[model samples]
Target chain A: MPNYPKGERRRAEILEAAFDAFGTVGYRNASMVQIAADCGVSRAGLLHHFPTKESLLEAVLKQRDRIDNEQFFAGGTSDDGLDYLTRMVRLVEHNAAHPGIVSLFAVLSSEASDPGHPAHVYFQERYARSRSWLRRAFRDLEQRGMLRPHVQPDGLDVEFLSLLDGLQVQWLLQPDAVDMPARVRAFLSRVLTEVA
Target chain B: MPNYPKGERRRAEILEAAFDAFGTVGYRNASMVQIAADCGVSRAGLLHHFPTKESLLEAVLKQRDRIDNEQFFAGGTSDDGLDYLTRMVRLVEHNAAHPGIVSLFAVLSSEASDPGHPAHVYFQERYARSRSWLRRAFRDLEQRGMLRPHVQPDGLDVEFLSLLDGLQVQWLLQPDAVDMPARVRAFLSRVLTEVA
Candidate 1:
């Protein structure tokens, strides 16, 4: 009974198919015709929403960021480092449930290391933003006297981000061998101590 | 000049060009014709040495592994954990001088996460072998009473490998912002204490 724009609905459907195609065989291997077919639309129909493959990829990445931000940070309850750590654990747990998206992210981000890559700027800013967020969380915890006295928030932020990424790659490669959430928790415990 | 097989010399030249091509644009984007052009050979001549692109990639990876093992572990002077840690720092320092290979590794390894990726098996075994190597080093340190009493070699191995990989990605993304060797050294000192 709810009214939604049919064009908008179709755009979402096209993006979904695009995500699947790009994530499975990767960008270079994915074809517009194939993605259109997957979406049950003609190639021109898909192009009406996304003029080019690059534009579609950008839209997909933006959508991914929006969904992640909503799911992980929108609760507004992360008052300190401990809360942030908890959210990270939850995010990893979430990632385990969705390997395809994670694979897409890993592959795209890695590919974007090339300065000429289409998503290079996007990924660069993404890492910078993530680092800043972690830095602020650590800063808040330090203000509240939760961090170990020797821990510098900036350095810890960098190290924590590295561990998060590194652990994800390992988990993706050998899912049965790694418990990502547990690893994150162990890292958190090693670096941060809760105030009594 | 020292006597060398003409075929062996030509093969080496071809591999050097292959490395340059693959490391610059990645595996999928690099063409045999471009690689042959770089080597100043005909495409048919290049194919004579490496029957396929996949074979060339495999050879490039193997060559990379050989150089890394030689530079980092050939001396066999890593008698204890501290020695092994020092070697790791040195390797990172060496890596700073060669960003191309590092970028290639970051891209290919991420791409290889897909089971269908040609290099997937190669990367999986590489990680396994690296983990085993680190485990032995940690185990040796444990035997020498170098590791913190609470730290188990197996867990430390996983953590160290994670940190190593994580740091590499960060360094590749923002080389000017990270001191890779210093980060490795700091992590080492935090986990292992010198026996007095």
Candidate 2:
């Protein structure tokens, strides 16, 4: 009734613009008016799609997660430990190719570390979900005797996640000095034998 | 010339206030006027000391680095690898107790990842210096055969720093769930046969 397809396309464009804005200057510093201008939409039109900056931020984060899932879990969440680690390497490789995506998460994740931040709960839940899945993968590795003798699965999930998150900042700051996929592979090999 | 000691005291107070503000709202969002107000200093007075926000940021970073060096290198930079690692653990323990300090770094280091950010060059040089020193430490360990058989010195410096930096975000987001020092110790123990 209201040109639904055109509306959807416009909405997608707004999301893309907001993602770049948020990634570049971060959410607090990013302006709605500027974002609207970036996407060639009026302020009212931008607000029509995203009622508030918070809503836009939410949409961008959701889009990011959706892309990550679609890319890595296309086969419906691999249960094999090796498959999971291999996918993680691919994900890091994918991230290296897209500095904007890495910058978005790196910026927002730290910015949202404040308890009062709008995305605080979002990041907390995201990390919890990541840790849970990683724990399952580590358990699978333990079952197959792939984890090294010194490798403890108890806090390994958080450590591994930290490694990935940490590597991103270094890679972003000094791209030539850090090879994200290589470092991730090195970490995985250190903890687990026969890393694929 | 005019109340030099008092001027120094006020500068210190301003630094403390800016550190807290920067940690809470990040550098881009932190307002100079608000920081001046927090320290009960007039805008002119604040400007008199720092001249610009960038200058204040530089001073705060220098203060942080000075504190770290004083606490860790009282003996003029330990040459022993075990002592260096032990000091690192102590540093992490110290950081866990100081959430504000950790927050300041976690927020700024990522925020400054943007090439145009004021502290961009500072963070780049800081990481370079850290990697160089860490590389030396690893080399010392390799020479003494303290590093495990599987441990490769190459890229280990960046990986270690990444683990530390990455762990800060998780710890800040969910402090109760993350034991920073413990996770650091675990990573160290995994790589080295004996961790002090």
Per-candidate TM-score against the hidden true structure: 0.90, 0.96
Per-candidate Cα lDDT values, in order, are: 0.76, 0.91
Model 1, A96: alpha-carbon shift in Å?
1.6
lDDT of 1 by residue, A80-146 (tens): 6678777877887888788877777877776677777788788778887877878888888888777
The most accurate candidate by DockQ is: 2
Please give, for residues B1-196, the per-residue lDDT of candidate 2 as tens digits: 2456898989999999999999988999999999999999999999999999999999998998988888788666768877888898899999899999899999999999999999999999999999998888889888999888998879889999999999999999999989999999988887787876
Candidate 2: docking tier: high
Question: Proportion of native contacts found in each model?
Answer: 0.37, 0.81
- Two-chain DockQ for each candidate model: 0.50, 0.83
Model 1 accuracy (lDDT, Cα): 0.76
Give the TM-score (0 to 1) of chain B in model 2.
0.95
Off by over 4 Å in 1: A1-5, A77-79, A149-154, B1-6, B77-79, B149-154
Q: Is the docking of candidate 1 incorrect, acceptable, medium or high quality?
A: medium
